[model samples]
Target: MTPYKSKKSFKTRLVIAISIVNLAVILAITYLTYRWNAQQLQEQTIAQTQQTIEQAGTNVSTYMDELYRLTLTPYYNDEVLSQLEYSPTNSRDKLNSKRVVEGFLSSVMTLPRSEILRVYIANDDSLYSYTRTPNDMPDLATYAESSWYNEAKETTKPLFIEPHMERVYGEKPTTVFSVVRQLRSKNDNSKTIGVVKVDADYSGISKICNKINLNAGGLLLIVNSQNQVLYRSAPIPSGLEDAMADGNKIGQSGTITLNGQKYLVNVLSLSNYSINIVALHSYRTLMAPLRSNLMKSIALAIFCIMLADIGFYIIIQKFTQQLFEIVALMHHVEDGDLTVKAHVTTNDEIGYLAESFNQMTEALQNVIDRNAQLAKEIYQAQYLAKEAQYNSLCSQIRPHFLYNTLNTISLLIKCEEYDTAIRAIESFSAFLGGVMNVSKDISLQKELDICQAYLKLVQLRYQDRLQYDISVSAELYSEQIPSLTIQPLIENAIKYACEQNRGQTVIHIVSCVSQDRYSIQVSDNGPGIKPETLESLQQRISTPSHDETEPAHVGNIGLVNIAKRLRLKYGNSASLDILSSDSGTTVSISLPFTKNEVTQ
Candidate 1:
């Protein structure tokens, strides 16, 4: 009953934990998705606004091109040019010229274009005027002093001037933008005769801006080179003019806060005129859809979490039903009721678990029935595990050395060192003969002889690059240890040393006896193993293999295999250790010296 209560509590806590995690994950996903979509909508709105500004700028440029072409009408007419150049000696001649020039200007204005409010030709002495509306024109002296006249006088190119109130006109002062160009004498192109001016109201600019739809609370403005607003689609926002000025200088898109409302601003320059098209979109209005989407996402997350919580409850209940039955069986078994078995009801994981539980209880009953036989069987299994480990290590050691020795002999024969090659073959044959003694135990003297023969073949291959020394007390020569154990360690030392450096590598094998433990130390003066590699090797060797059916070891697993064989043969009384530094590495094997025989 206590176990059942604990499992029920655990199941309840697990369900709560899973539900909380699911809710947190779903809410986070909802928020992140909303943020991503909002960012995308912002970028898209900005791009669209910029594109519309570009289109409006193009339209305004085309309109200004037409107005500039109107200013060139005097150059196309011979009479107009003669009138412009005429320096009349009397008022009658002046009046005649004025009549002709004004008539020509009047004809130019009659082209069904309402945007052109007036046209004027002026010189230092006189001013001629034509207008759709009968408004007063500035005198020649007043026109000469104006900014447009001075700018036109300096450059032959038409100058598009900023807007200013035409206070001289009748009824009320009208706001007008004008294009002016200096007229030069046809006979002498460098000599200035007069200047022509064409004034336009905001109608054409308004038409271009109106063609673009900037949603609600959006603004479009046309500003002259002086940052003066020439046309506006809606009411102007404060600080927008300053932003436009900075934007024109830098020529980039940005966002600004205007009157406590965020606005995305984009500026497009009119290439044909010294003007810019500034478009402003309300950030709140543009992101309205994103707000809507965020609400939907949050609602969906709530629904999903609620649905997931219900589903988790159902699943936990279904899974824990079988789990509770297994728990009850476990309780019975804990009380020594081995006959209790969990009924298997389905072919799922729960069913398999129930079946395994039944098998476990039956096995427990069987183990109780045959305690003596089970102990004997366990002993035999341990012996087999040790024997299997030994044979696996021996097999790995035998094949690789043969390949190295044979390859060395082949290289020597190819060099025509027939005597040395024959001696290497003799050493190889002796080494193989000694290695074939598959007994699990071998005398230390016999192991030393095999190592000596192996080293001779290695010497024949490396020549002066290799050197070795073996020192053992004569009394300890007959000490029995695991076969192929010391030889593989020596091989590992020589193999690492010669492979890493061209300089001479020294291998020293010495035996020491202290009290009851005999130790063999193999030292190498090769480039030592890296700290990480040495640590990994130590970890691999120290862990005992529990599975006998594991695949045959490969690579440098030979070191690990030898360590395992030693552990199996002598149990905890034996150990293999590796010590290394930048200078060198040493491998030590320690075995208890009780007759030098392994545990049964």
Candidate 2:
């Protein structure tokens, strides 16, 4: 025998191999754990951001609503409404009316609110103003041409205007959003008197939004429906400005890349005010801690792997000689020489392992011999079981069709139509003969004939109430289809159309060929199946039957049975599809052209 030689000893190779495997396993676990934690943390952050935005939106809405109530203050004061209706021709009466309106507006502004900068009342004849800050008033002559005034006129409710720098306050250039409402005559409510305008600065809304904490470099924006930013904590990025136009583009909360950095965006809509509060959180900043921890974990794992390899090297050195003998025998077994055995010199763990190895090889040889004997039997059993299942599905269709045809004939006889009854009996006999050989497939031509016979029987029973048209090319008729395939579909259309509908029902049977598929469609002009029933039927046909021998007794048994037979014959290459609406339902069966011939 050649002397056994290895470039490296078993102890050194084992220590290296074990160290590499341990390192790989540790890295994979660390990576997966990091990923899971990252996903969970991101989701939590997004959820919290959404909640915060909603709360801030609520606060803003409450503040705006309170401000709106202030605009209605004129209606509460009879003196202000009376002064709004005054239009004096003389300068003395005009000055007195102006004093009354200004006094009322000043009292309204003095209600302990610092945000309300100006209040004004205007009409066709004159304008009055009260200012809490040093600001010039807008011209009453040009006020009606303003966009906010036009919008305010459209509704009786107070209108909240978008933020803009007040043109009248030219020196200070104060940005303000205003509430404008129409002042109507109290005695004649439909008669217009004047309008009240309340201009408030952004300090109130800013205070509400400032409560949100989005970490460093994050932003919170208050925007209108037109995507105009009313307030933002930071300057808008380049692409992010256009992205905010469609809420559907970036849903309520998700991640987006802006300025080469990722961010988490959350949105809350104030529909009543046409406002949205958007929060942006920095993705890099949020995950910085996680990345740092991952790096530390990897460093610790490397150190642990080195320590474990050192300990494993010392332990493996103690028993390598004994294991080497067993390993050599294992090499012989791997080379198909199972007769080789290891020499046992001790009753320790290694000795027991060697004995068990010999017993395992002996048992494996026995199992291989038994498996060869069982394979043939199992295959034959499966073949018989499949055949039985196919035959059983075929048998189920015959009795159901037979019972219905016999009932139709009985109904015809009771109607005193002796000649039609005899004709029906003859057609029923022909249809019965067709279904007699249920185990074999027939050509599409024969299947069409079978469907025609069934339709003829149904047409006789319902007389003029049923009309059907069958159109298929003669060249395509040679394609083979499973027995009882097309007949059941035609029967289903007739039953729901003629039996369920009182009016005349029309059905169309057509066939067409595409790329590599041949499809036959059956459609009707009767009321269609309900959505729930159609879904149940489609599900039953799509799902495979767990028990091959179980009969198709649920949800349109005829359809379920035909679909199953098609699947059994052609596998998934065959399909049954259903389309329906209030107008009608269409059922189509598409089969691969390559499978046009019977598989037997």
Candidate 3:
């Protein structure tokens, strides 16, 4: 009996040692599996975020390239420059020259998505022809000695002017970007006849900057080579220009904080200009999922530890019996069953076996929780994919509208109202063409032309009630702008400024270039908009206040569209500021001066 008891004690010790070893093995496996799964999740998330950012950068670069082609190429070509050269010898000749220039301006403005504000020609010390009806034609003599003219004289390359406010266009100021091309006499290649200048409305660029699709709290900023902020969304912080200038480089990615939000920023440098495209995405928001996952993993580990401690002590009695039960529980856990528990009936080896069994069950529970989480992630991904498809479909609507409008113009031309038909056809052609080339970076002059064509159509439709004036310096025409920017503003002007008035309404358009930025102002001498309306205009917040019984002027589609487009194109660089009181309503746009050239 004594020998039998001794043998039983020895066996119990052996079983207890084996049970502890088994518990350690189970813990090790659980830790390894959890860590491996976490690492995979982290890697996948980082890769997806990086791909999304990279794709956005590529899209922006492609758009800028297209803009250059549509807007700047025509200004650089010899044929267009020669025709724009100043050449009037007398007053009568000057008038004829003005008509010719006007016709040229009309043609340029009609280019789809062109941003040209105006076209002007300067002969030796004289403003010869301009889109603006010159008041006692400004002495071009002094301008000849100016930096822009000197630059044009020296390089003979198209010059891009900086942003400035126009003194001649009244207090409602706008930005201008100029392109100056040297004109050589046809008879003598060495003889410099004059200079052809194209003024592009900077407002259009602002519009483009405002239209960029950005993540919540994300910003898009446009900075010229000189590091000046050409445009910014409202409430711009000081010193932003310095930051952009300091960090300008192609494909440079980094972190920045704006308005207390941390962002992952990427910069894309324009090929032809000294302009940089800065895109921002919120870093915190991007990493939220990872943080949540990590917390869940930690909680799972704690739950596993608690279960192992409690479950092991409650199940053991005899050594041999407990050994077999613990082994069976481990097998069940490995087979993905957390419900199986060890049934041991001894205080010695059986108790240890029970502890090992509990550890296995806890580890299995963690695996089950992880699987549930993965299932949730898959469902969320599917939902996001569906949302993306919906947004893509919505974006295609504008192009469809453009096609229908073009078709209508073609039909009208066939009806034979020759003069009106030609004008309508040209306007419609330009509008549709601009829409198709929406990705290009255009010159200010081209953008202005687009606006003019759009305004002409509006004027024709509204005839007696709508009239417009535009003033732009010849010095500010060649600057690069985003394509199809200005027409929307003009459309807004016609819709909101003239639609309600039986009396004649005058819409003033002006552009100027200063040192580092440019601005465009569109104002109307009609009943000013309400304060609430002006507030909504600048913030781009649209709240429908009009019922079916309300007048059409109460809610103008063009105005809302302009605001939406501006937000998308410029991101943070472009802004729409509306000021209205007893005085007329004015919409001002500002943008940076970038000397971006179009590639062939």
Candidate 4:
């Protein structure tokens, strides 16, 4: 009952443990997939936003390129450039030069731009000038010392001046971004001729920038090479402006806080113009679509997991149900239900196991039925054998032994050898007492004493012809053996060697430890048995074999009987071994040996 409960408890815990481990694995995989997909979505969104910004930057660069080309046309005109160096000698020539310069300027002015506020050419001598606003030209010497002239003097390329209000009028005026170019003499490249400057209306710049934005609340601004903001959809935030001024090459799409709202700041460098575009996109606005998609995906994955978990639970429950049925069958078998059969549900390992168990149970029930039929006969046979063995142990010493010893005492008493007679009597008494005890086994020392007493009695009968020696080590004193086990071998030696032979018969008894076994040996120096007899006797001594027709010996037991008792007491671990040759015969008794006491 206790074992069945424990097994059921273990099965339940094992199922729970497997389920928990599987659930943990599923959760970990889901979390990793979610994180990886989210990261990929974020990277793709940022790249797409940057691509749009670059496209807008290209459009702004094209607008700047058009302005550069428009400023270059007047510088390349030879007619307008020639008048800058023409010095008129009289009134008619001066008027003729003015008429020629005015016509050329009028043609330039008629070319397509409505936003060109004015185009002017001026020199130190005031040789010629063209302007949209009358009296707009400044004094040449003082203007040459200004920042725009100094900057233009340094480069032959067209330079776009930063947007500023025209200061020629005393009051504040229209804002303009101007292109300044220094005119060179047509013949001598180094000659100081005049400077042509075109100012663009502010509305044209507003057209280029105002139409572009990255996202809602996103700031779009264009900065010159010096990092000053020239045009913007919104004012540049201070943090971004400072980063730009410091010339730090910040990476695209990083978080920045603007007016307590997070924005992703990105910059685009225009290759065709001396400007960089900074765009600040609101982070939340940019991620809104991706967030919606991610939520949908997560919800779908969770729904799938829920369905899978339900299926897994049902499968595990069915699996445990099959196991429980097998366990119930085992419990019946434990309670001695050899007729019980386990029901097979599935063709898995558990099902195969249940099938094998059912087959074993049926086979076991059949064997039990067969064994019950033979029980009485076997018991009767075993009882008769045990009774024979008991009687044999009780009378191991022959009646002739007692008769001869009593006759030896009579001879000793007549010879007045009292001490020898009394010693013989005492030895006989001890040997008789040991044989009377019902214990089938005795210690090695006790068996040895009985053997010695039997030998001593035999010695008195043939005092000169019989010679014997006993050898034993003290360590084997407590080793157990069948009572009177060794005495029969010694008596057999005396009977065969002393009674049959003419020459002196010498017997040797020795005990020793060998190979984790206690061995007692009885040997004799006498004529050996015939070869055929020795082999036949060894077969019987190897295992106790009997024919039912054969009669028992009336006086004493034989070596085959002793072998039977040895097998009974110690199974195959104890033995009686016999060997014979021309010189002698040796009989050995081997028992399972250990230092610990063994009870029989």
**Highest lDDT: which candidate?**
2
Give a tens-digit lDDT track for model 3, residues 1-600. Answer: 354466457545654545565556655666676567655744554454455545644664465444434334434445544544545578896666556555654665434445554565665645544344222213344777777666666655566565444533434344555667666665576776666666655556666666655554455666666565555554344445445457743357666665676656666665455566666555666556555665665555544544454455344433345565565566776776788777645667558668767776778688889999999999999767645543443353355345535554666667775787777777777765755664455667777776776677656555778888889654456666556556556655565667777789999889867887778888888778888767766554344332211222334444554444444455466666677775578877777666443211
lDDT of each: 0.77, 0.78, 0.58, 0.68
Ranking by TM-score: 2, 1, 3, 4
State which candidate has the highest TM-score. 2
lDDT of 2 at 333: 82
Name the runs in model 4 displaced over 4 angstroms.
1-38, 52-62, 75-78, 89-103, 106-111, 127-141, 150-155, 160-175, 188-190, 201-217, 225-228, 234-253, 269-274, 292-600
Query: What TM-score should be assigned to candidate 4?
Result: 0.37
- Each prediction's total of clashing residue pairs, residues at least 3 apart in sequence or on different chains, is 0, 0, 76, 0
lDDT score of residue 365 within candidate 1: 89
The alpha-carbon lDDT assigned to residue 9 of candidate 3 equals: 71
**Candidate 2 lDDT, tens digit per residue, 3-55?**
23451443356556667777788889998999999899889888887878888
Point out the higher-scoring one by TM-score: 2 or 3. Answer: 2
Q: Which scores higher on TM-score, 3 or 4?
A: 3
lDDT per residue as tens, model 1, 507-561? 9999898788889999998889999988888877787657633543565655777
On a 0 to 1 TM-score scale, where does candidate 1 land against the true structure? 0.41
Give lDDT: candidate 4, residue 105: 60
C-alpha positional error of residue 24 in candidate 4 after TM-score superposition, expressed in Å: 17
The candidates, ranked best first by lDDT, are 2, 1, 4, 3
**Model 1 residue 146 CA deviation in Å:** 4.7
